[model samples]
Target: MILWFTYILVAIAALGGLLCVVLGLAGRRPSDLTVGILGLLELGLIAQVVISIIAPFAGNPPTGSLLEFWVYLVTAVLIPPAAVVWALLERSRWSTVIMGIAALAVAVMVWRMQVIWTVQGS
Candidate 1:
């Protein structure tokens, strides 16, 4: 995994989590901006996936087992869209909570990716 890209994902997730907290505390519904940020996060995740795919062929196979890598990749790619869809249906502060959960999950996934890479490297 690319350290810089993982950092970018973590940064975006942190920002999203902050936004969710602000919206929840203010008793406001999740806005388009929240969803937009999620979209941006998703884009970053997709870029990570693409890079992962290319790296191996470029003679830089990822450190993790393929199964572990795929699990992280699929979850990272799916979470934002799933969160957006689920949030849209709720229309409450809970939607923000859901977004928060999604952000946290992304953060965890990035950490896991790092761990997987490190374990493989050793």
Candidate 2:
């Protein structure tokens, strides 16, 4: 688990969250641009999950409880798509706001995962 990659991913998630929030507050619906940004964040999250799965075998497993780490990872993996679905269901600025919330959650979760895997490394 490269710390720099994880840190960058976290930053992207945070910035993505801020973008969505700003769009929502500005009275804009979930546009193609927002969806694209969310997709990119999802890609990063999925990449992290893949990394987490392979890290154990690579001899750098998380020192914290694997169950908890897996739980957080799985939840993070679902956030973007779920938010997109929610935004699709309702075509209002608030829908984008919901996605904004999801993005924030992704940021926090990514940061937490990094702590579990790197800071607490066994």
Candidate 3:
């Protein structure tokens, strides 16, 4: 994994999470803004997936257990869509909060993936 891209993903996810949290706390239900932010986060995750696929061929193969890294990557890619679906169906302030939590979770998971890719050994 590229270190800089990881940082970018974390930043986007963290900021989006915080924004959703604040909106939820302000008594808002899920909105287009929240969904759009999640959509962007999902796009970033998809890009990360592509990069991970290509990086090994480019001579940046992960030092960690490849299975572990792939598992984390796949799960991280799923979170945003899951949260968005939940929010859409629930349409409650708490659902917005759940989306925030999901985004925050993705940020942490992405960071873990970075550690596994760059620091851990198989």
Report lDDT per candidate.
0.82, 0.86, 0.95
Candidate with the larger lDDT of 1 and 3: 3
| Model with the higher lDDT, candidate 2 or 3 | 3
Which candidate has the highest TM-score of all? 3
Error of 1 at 3 (Å): 0.8
Q: Show the colliding residue pairs in model 3.
A: none
Q: What is the TM-score of candidate 2?
A: 0.93
Leading candidate by lDDT = 3
Clashing pairs in 2: none
Give a tens-digit lDDT track for model 2, residues 5-119.
Answer: 7888888888888999999999999999888888999998888878887888999878877877888989998989999999998989999888888988998998888787777
For residues 1-122, could you state the per-residue lDDT of candidate 1 as single tens digits?
A: 77787888898888787888678667877788888888988898888888887877877666767788779878988998898888899878888778878887888888788678656753
Output the worst ten-in-a-row residue range by lDDT, candidate 3. 113-122
- Each candidate structure's TM-score, on Cα atoms with residue i matched to residue i, is 0.90, 0.93, 0.98
